[model samples]
Target: MRVAFVSMTTTRHRDTEGNRRLERLAHQLADRGHDVTVFCAAWWDDYRDKRTIEGVTYHGVTVSPAPTSFAARLPVLLARYRPDVIHVRPRPPRAVFAASSGGTLARAPLVLEWYGDEELADSRTVRLLLREATAVVTPSEMVRTQVRERDVADERSHEIPDGIDFSLIEDTEPGEEIEVAFAHPLDEAANLDSLLLALAELRGRDWSVTVVGDGPLRPDYERQAADLRIDDRITFAGECSQQERIAIYRGAHTFVQTAYREYFARELLRALAAGCVGIVEYQAESSAHELIENHRRSFRVTDPQELADAIVESGDLERRTIDEDFARFDHRQILEAYLDLYRDVQESHGVL
Candidate 1:
C-alpha cells in the first residue's frame, strides 16, 4: 500500500514524542514493504528540500512556520504523492485545511491521527472538515472520548492506543543508589512546583531525585528546589535521545509525570518498559488516572507527601508486572496496529 503522512514537523526537525511517533510509523510501514512518504514543513535551515530517511521519503514543503498557512500546501502534495491512504498527524489549523481540501482533491481515504487536543480549531469548521475524513485515530480512550464528544461520527473514529518502541528497554540494575526522576519541560502546567514542595518533605529520604527535560521554567524550578532545601538531592538532565532516555529510565527506581494537560503519558510508559515503578500526579479526568487504575503497579499521588510516599513504597510492587504491561505494547505490536489501520482504510475506500 502507498501511504502519505502529512504533519507540520518531522522527528528530524524537532525531537518531540509526537515527531518520534510520526517517524516510527513511517519507518515501520516502509519496512513492512509498504510505500510510505511523509510531507512536512522545511523545519531545518540546512535541509529545505525533499529527501528520504531510513526508507521513508519526505517532502519538505516550504510554507509559513504557522499551521494556518501551511495547510495550503498539503493538497498539492497529496495529489502529487497520490498515496493509497493520506494519514495526517495533529495540527489543528492544518487538520482543518487538509480535511477540507482532501475531501475534494484526495482520491484515497483520509485518516486523521490526533495526538493532542484540537480544541483550538473552530468547532463548526472542524466538524465540517471532519466530515471529510474516512477515519480518525486517537492514541487513548480518553482522547477517543474527546473526539466522540466533539460530535465526530462514531463510525469514523477508532481508538488505537499510542505505543512505545520497547526495543529501547535496557534496564540497569537498581544500583547502590536509587534516583526518582520527574521528566517534562519545567512549566506551570508541569506542576513541578508542587512536586518540588513534595520532594522537600523527603529531606532525609534515602533516594535522590532528578528532573530531566528543560524549558523556560527551569530557573523557577531550580529556585523552588533551593527553597525546599533539597537542591542537593535534585539534578536536572535536559532533553535526551532515545538511548539516553531509556538508560535514564533504566537507572531510576521511580518515574513521575507531573503534567496537567498531557493526552497520553508516553514517557511514563517508556519508564515502565525499562522496569521503573511509575507515579503520576492525580487528576480525575486526566489520562494518568486511567493508567494507574488499570495498571496495578502504577500509583497516583496528588500532594508532595503522597508523591514521596509512593516513591518510597515502589519497592514493594513487583517490577515484572510493570514490565509485562509495557512489553505488550512493544514496537513490533505497534507496527502491526498501523498496518491493520492502513489496510482497513485502504479496503474501506478501495484505495488498494
Candidate 2:
C-alpha cells in the first residue's frame, strides 16, 4: 500500500512525542513493504527539502513560522505523490484544511490521527476534517470519549494507543537505596513540585530518586528538593540517551509520573516494560491512570501523600507480569492494527 502522511512537524524538525510517533509509524510501515511518504513543514536548515530516512521518503514543505505557505503547497505535493491513502495528523487548521482538500483532489481516503483532546475543542475545523475523513484514530479511550461527546466521527473513530519498542528495553534487578525513577521535561505543568514534596514526606525512608529529562524548571525543582532537605537523595541526571533511559528504568524499583495532563504515558509504559513498578497520579486529563488501574504492581494516587505512600509500598509489590499488562501496546501489534485499519479503509473506498 502506498501511504502519504501529512503532519505539521516531524522528528527532524522537533523532538516531541507526536513527531517521533509519526516518524516511527512511517518507518515501521515502510519496513513492512508499504511505500510511505511524509509531507511535513520544514522547520530547520537540513529539513528544507526532500530526504529519505529509514526507507521512508519525507518531503519538507518550506514555510515561515506560520503554516500558511506550507498549507498552500500541500495540495500540489499531495497530487504529485498520489498515494492510495492520506493519513493526516490534524493540528493547525490550515494544515487540516490543506490535507483534506488535497486528499479530495487526489481521490484518496483520508485518515485523521489525533494524539489528544485538543482538536475536539476546535469545533469548526474538527467538523470539517471529520466530514472529509475516512476514519479517525486517537491513542486513548479518554480522548475518544471527548471526540464522541463532541459528535466528531463517532462511528468512524478508533482508539489505537502509541506503542513502545519493547525489544530495546532490557530487564535488570532493582538497585539498592530503593531507586525511584521520574522523567519529564521539567516544565511547570510537570507537577515535579508535588513529587518533591511527596518525597520529602518519606523522611527516613532509604529511597533515592533519579530525575531524568531536563527543561527550564530543573533549577527550581533542585531548589525545592534542597528546601525539603532531600536534595542529597535526589540526582538530577538531566537529559539522557535512549539507552541510558532504558537502563535507568530497568534499575529503578518504582517509576512515578505526576503530570497534570498526559495524553498517553509513553515513559510509564517503558518503565513497566523494564520491570519497574508503576505509580501514577490521577489527573482528570491524563490517561496514565487507565494503564495501571487494576494491575498488581501498579497504582494510582490522588495526592502527594498518596503518591508518597505508594512509593514506600511499591518495594513490597510483586513484579508485574509484563505480558498481560503490555500486550496491547506491543509495536508489532500496533503496526498490524494500523495495517488492518488501512485495508478496511481501502476496501470501503473500493481501492483495495
Candidate 3:
C-alpha cells in the first residue's frame, strides 16, 4: 500500500507530539515494505524537491511552512503521487482543504488524524473536513467524542491510540528505585502543582519521587515543590531519554498523570508497561484517565488530595518488572491496526 502523508511541517521542523507520531507511523509503515511518502514543507537545507531518509521518502511541498503557498501546491502534488490513501492533519486547515481537493482528484480516501490539540477557530471549516474525510482518527475516545460532536458518523470516527515499545520496557534495567514517579514536560499545561500538593499530603510518609522532563516552567515547579516542603524527597531529574525514563518507571512503584491537557497519556503508558501502578487525575480536557479506566492497578482522581490517597494505596499492588497486559499497544500491533483501517477504507472506496 502506498500512503501519502500530508502535513505542512514534520518533527524535523516543528517537533510536536502530533508530528512525531506521524513520523513514527510513516517510518514504521515503510519498514514493513509498504511504499510511504511524506508530503511536507521542506526542512532540509538543500533545495531538492524530495529526499528519502530512513526508507520513507519526503516530498517537500514548500520551502517553508507557508500555509497559503503550501495549500496552493498540495492538491497537484498529492494528485500526482497517486497514493492508495491520503493521510493528513487539520493543523493548517487550508492544507486539509487542499488535501480534500487532491483526494478528489486522485479518487483516494482522505484520512484525517485529529490530535484534538489544535484550535478550532472556524467550526464550519472543521465540520466540512469532518464530513468529507473518509475516516477521522483520534488518539483516544476523549478526542473521538469531540470529533463526533461535529456531526461525524460513528463509523467515520475511530480511536487509534499511541504506540508503545513493550520490548524496551522488558529489557531496560531498573534505575534508582523510587516510591513515586511523574513525567511530563514542565510547562504551564503540565499541572505539576497538583502532583506537588499531592506529595505534600504524603509529607510524613517514607516516600521519594523522581520528576522527569524540563521546560521554561522548571524553576517555578522547583519553587512550588520547595514551598510544599517536599523538595527534600523529590528529585527533579530534568529531561531524560526514553531509556532513562523506562528505567525509572521500572524501578518506581507508581506513576501519576496530572497534566491539564493530554490527548493521550503517553508517559503514563510507558510507566504502566514498565509495571508502574498508574494514578491519573481526571481533567475535562485530558484523556489521561482513559488509559487507566480499565486497569485493576490504577486509580482516577479529580484533585491532589485524591491523588495522594491513591498513591499511598498503590503500595499494596505487587511490583512487576513488566506487565504483558499492554502488549496490544506495541508499535507493531498499532501499525497493524492502521493497516487494517487503511484496507477497510480502501475496500469501501473500491481502491483495493
Q: lDDT of all predictions, in order shown?
A: 0.72, 0.80, 0.91
Order of quality (TM-score): 3, 2, 1
Worst window of 10 by summed lDDT in candidate 3: 11-20
- Descending-lDDT candidate ranking: 3, 2, 1
Per-residue lDDT, model 2, residue 307, is 88
> Which candidate wins on lDDT?
3
C-alpha RMSD in Å of predicted model 2 compared with the true structure: 2.7
Candidate 1 local lDDT, 32-135, one digit each (tens): 88898877777555745677778888776664355665676677777776777788766655554674475357677888877655445577666665666778
Q: Count the backbone clashes (under 3 Å) in each candidate.
A: 1, 0, 0
* lDDT tens per residue, model 2, 1-352: 8999988666655566666777789999999999999888655466358778789887877653358888899998998888899998777667878887888778788888877734346576677766668888888888788667656756688888889777666343333334689988898768898789898999888888899989999898898899999999899999987777777877777889898878888888888877789899888988888778767788888899998988888878754324345656779999999988988888887876
The weakest ten consecutive residues by lDDT in model 2 span 170-179
In terms of lDDT, the poorest run of 10 residues in model 1 is 170-179
TM-score of each: 0.85, 0.90, 0.97
